[model samples]
Target: MGVGGRFGARESCGTARGVLQRVLDADRGVFETVARRHWPGADALLPRLSRAADHGVLWFAVAGAIAASRTPRARRAALRGVGSLALASATINTVGKRSVRRARPLLDVVPLVRRLEKQPHTTSFPSGHSASAAAFATGVALESPGWGAAVAPLAGAVALSRVYTGVHYPMDVLVGAALGVGAAFTARALVPTRDQARPPARPRAEAPALPHGAGLIMVVNSASGSSERALALRAALPLAKIVECEPQALEDELERAASLARVLGVCGGDGTVNAAARIALRHDLPLAVLPGGTLNHFAYDLGVEDVRGLARALERGDAVRVDVGMFSTEQRRGIFLNTCSLGVYPELVRERERWAGRIGGWPAGLLSAVRVLRADRHPLEARFQGRTHPLWLLFAGNGTYHRMGVMSGRRTDLADGQLDVRVVHGGRWPAVRLLSAALAGPLTRSPAHAAVQVPHLHMEHVSPGTLLAYDGEVTHVRGAVTLRKLPRALTVYRPMP
Candidate 1:
């Protein structure tokens, strides 16, 4: 792959990117209302939080109910070590923040929804409270054998409390937690004691330095079900940095891939392929198609006819820019704001969402998909831009679909700054026809595949079965829907070849 792509933000995120912003708002609400003088910078908070967390996690992990829960010596060492390193990390971060000196919240004069009860003291660039909570929590996770499992949630709750109480910005909290986790991990790494198997540091494979411009690596998941696409990635692209996109981890990984990618690829369905494009904003990474599962859409976009072609794409591939959709959030993870549905498709996903390992793998997902298509492809009312759109089904996209899909064609240009919207006014017959055409394309002559493309549209499931699909996966928000364009809001990676 050769060149790069561009991206932008969605108007939707402006309104719905509330998870972190809400936390910030909450901080302004309660904390600023109470205090007027100062707030801690994110950096300052990390060191302090790290020290506190190290103390708490290490102590409780080995000394109390956690240890009594049956702690192993090596695990105990890793936990204690994690705290020590966290403290060191805090020292470095606090000094760094001080030097950076970002402005704190306007504790003194900023308007509030309510009157202040008191005042606060410290810088406000980063959230000290959040950092502390994250550090403390992560440190605990590092050290606790098993019984102390409650630490993670407790820490997260405390961090949220900081936002709820108005002590720190959401970014501050995230940064602080990052510091804490870094410290704990560093501390753990320093422990001479894995005294166990060889540490990652001592591994033979690590001999190759990850060059600053290391070749871009993409890990696509294609398994229709719960096969370890992750495992496949770890095995095939060991040199590439690893980021897991298991349903729960997709958003985080997408963010990482967008930021660090040279090329991005997937291993799942058309959904997974589309999911990758959702975040493929501006990083302009050539996409490499890898087939691990089934119905690989983005893979198809790359012109890889089969698994063998997937390998060939990686070998003799060229870089191409692609369009992507953006989302506000997912009930379980990050939202792509595009179509990953469920009413019809979700019914299928739901059947096996909980089934895991081999028993809950591909067969189950396949069976579920078929059942939902046959039983739950319920039609619904929809609204777009502003008009009512009566429909049997709908799929609004971020990128234009010109000819083929992932692996078959190029990833559409991302800088075009638009949404690729497709709607299916489906009924039983059309659905059947569409399915038949999908299996054997000559059926395209049928009315069932009444698919067309547009930009900036909205959808709603009035008849409601559960058709909310976000970034290729199903979600649970049914009713009048909205889809707004956020042009070029993100960045993705491409190869330099």
Candidate 2:
């Protein structure tokens, strides 16, 4: 090489080293400045706050409180927050810490009062606590703006505490928080938020514009634990007749209300809504659903979230026609607004109901799942498309259910006039087969399960008294049952954009 070429190469190398040294000097300078600063109340608060966030105890407690509100949206927000936190924490420990093996800052400049009683022993390039805080806050905000706003202050304080307690540099907290936000977005990308894919407001229908719910009669299933929502509806619509009834009296009261009212309204879970939908269909009355139940699948898909949402729809006279699903036998017929399933799921539902009253709902569901999966039960024998097969589960939704990341089975269109039929083929291990089917995507065929979209599904020669579950309710059917869609059969109230 010539002398000039060698000198030019040396100069470039020297310039790169100078820039790197300057960056390091600036980083250390900022750390020292923060360490020496005195904030009035931080000495007493920041250290304890940092300790509370250890092992995510604070976040988990917050999640439990949010879920205890018993609203579907709140629960979802809580779940998403935890999911994002998990992703961020995993990435920080696995990749962020390992990739950058930077040393912790010297504590000589930091105030003794502000320092944590026990210092962090890990590398200090990126802050794990800051990442968790940012991820959780961002995730909650994506799902629910109000909850996110409520949580943001705490998340910020936690992040600030990392720096105030001499545990993380400002850049560490900043980069960690950025990575945390990215993790939340990544989780949302995997499982899109409800606002990301709202159901289409199509096939508009005509319903009376009941100002203050003048001619509306609503039935509240008291047994379904919707008294609070019923009261809210009453306060919102003073003229509306709100009848609260027990489980046994729900049907009778709904029938009476439908006969007397210009509009039929119902509050409770999916089961109560299902009953109301049937009466509304028979009387040809437009239905206004107030979601007062856990997992209000049908009402959520219809875009009716709470009492206020339904109230706005009623006042605005905004309504849409949606398809209803029907499963009929020679002797009996029933309709489902969400989904209908035959097999282990129905058995699981029955088992859950039996134990739900004794041990509470969540625990009972877990027990039921374990019992049903462990029980010595044979698969259901049925004929599908001229072929007889042993099936562990046959699920048919009123509309096509789409997968959102790890979370599957959410519908974007409720009036597509098609039934989503998913079958988990019989296998030796029911739990393994069910898990595989759940993880599989829509329309993807695996050894354990297969999914298809069809206008209708016909099953022949089923055994007498085969259990069937539809929209959280269980029943029995036998001998040549057919599942079909009633296109745009039900008119429901929803706030339109």
Candidate 3:
């Protein structure tokens, strides 16, 4: 670069170092006093604690334990903690240490008895161990305040151990702790927190029951969980026609059933049910949904938790009319029963699916969020509400999903005739806003993000070939897209109150 630029950079670096050294000088006397008078037992124990956190094994073990716990909230907090640690480590070890290259405190100042068995040789203005501890603790707290509270003491202990062991100055430890907290917030922005449960879906109108599923054809997805319970499904609705189909043949099978049966039924997860909803809409046939997916969000909302539940609903002819979300791009038009989105979420879904089989969905989802957020930084370009700007995610929910944590939940009214439109606005620190939303939710609202309920929205000037995810199915769409609610367009079987 130029001489002026080089001089300016050096001046800035010098100023920072001067300030840090001044802080260290002020605390050095107390740090030395603590180091000289350390207890004999702690002399050995403190070093071991430092080494345990050296490669971050301690934090990883703690995170793994939390993730392995049966509690869902604990698992989520663990992932968030780990993700924050990852960010802190990267910043402290690579960026902070390399750029500043601050020398470690002289061991001579410390008492002979307090000298560590193995002191670090690298530049050490900031303690990486302190950073990791602080970041992990802060990240966990963002997810679960109670768990965070539990971890705070340990985090403080770890941060203090850096100075107690004579490896880092009090200032270094303090700076590391600050960096760590910043890392946790950064990770939060990238990964969404657990979605809170919404109020139950409100039942709309109902239809008369059919006898033993007579004249009803059910397309069963063999890949879905229903296949394992095939016998139970058959026993539940013996008179209904069941056609087992693979993922590839699901649409064709549903189409054939739509033409042949008076009522079309589907036994699968939300994605499968979403497909069935489209066909049911086109064929003007009422849908019978049997809850069979992992979460069964849609089926549960429809009040069909099992085959028997569906049968009872159908036998009683209890059905409800629900709104559908439609998004049309230049390539094609489609429908959704739950939600659609662009930006970080679609990539998260793809990553989660890739790992879900090996580690299960929730854990895989957390892992995927970390991986994608750490790697994917660029924002997508899209135009909405007459303005073109970068965005992290633009979500449109069928019928207005209630905001719950980082994700949305069940709509109180399924036929509300509105799309829940939420966008994480792109800005100087889009990730920060995203993380704040994930943690604090709508309470973090500002110019950086927005959420609204609307009957229709036209998203113009979208980049061609941008991926739009709807009901877990991703479609590459180019150009402008229209998102509108199909008010009470599809009739679906549900239990009567």
What does each candidate score in C-alpha RMSD?
26.8, 2.7, 14.2
Q: Name the 10 consecutive residues with the lowest summed lDDT in model 3.
A: 194-203
Clashing pairs in 2: none
Q: Candidate 3: lDDT of 155?
A: 84
Question: Where is model 1 poorest over a 10-residue stretch in terms of lDDT?
Answer: 198-207
Give lDDT tens digits, candidate 1, residues 394-414: 555555534322111223344
TM-score of 3: 0.58
Highest TM-score: give the candidate number.
2
What's the ranking of the predictions by lDDT, best on top? 2, 3, 1
**Number of the candidate with higher TM-score, 1 or 3:** 3
TM-scores for all candidates: the values are 0.38, 0.90, 0.58
Order the candidates by TM-score, highest first — what do you get? Answer: 2, 3, 1
Candidate 1: where is the Cα deviation over 4 Å? 1-295, 303-318, 327-343, 352-366, 373-378, 385-390, 397-422, 426-449, 460-465, 484-497
lDDT of 3 by residue, 1-497 (tens): 99999999999999999997887678787778777774757776676777788788989988887777534467779988988999999998788898877788878867665666788888887889999999999999988787899889888878878888789888788999999999998776666553323223344555656787788898989888577455666777788788998989999999999999989988888899988988988899999887667656777555555565677888888777888888888889988888899988888888888999999989998999888777747788987767888988888877665544344455656787878787887765655767765554532467778778889998888887677888887878778889888788888877664
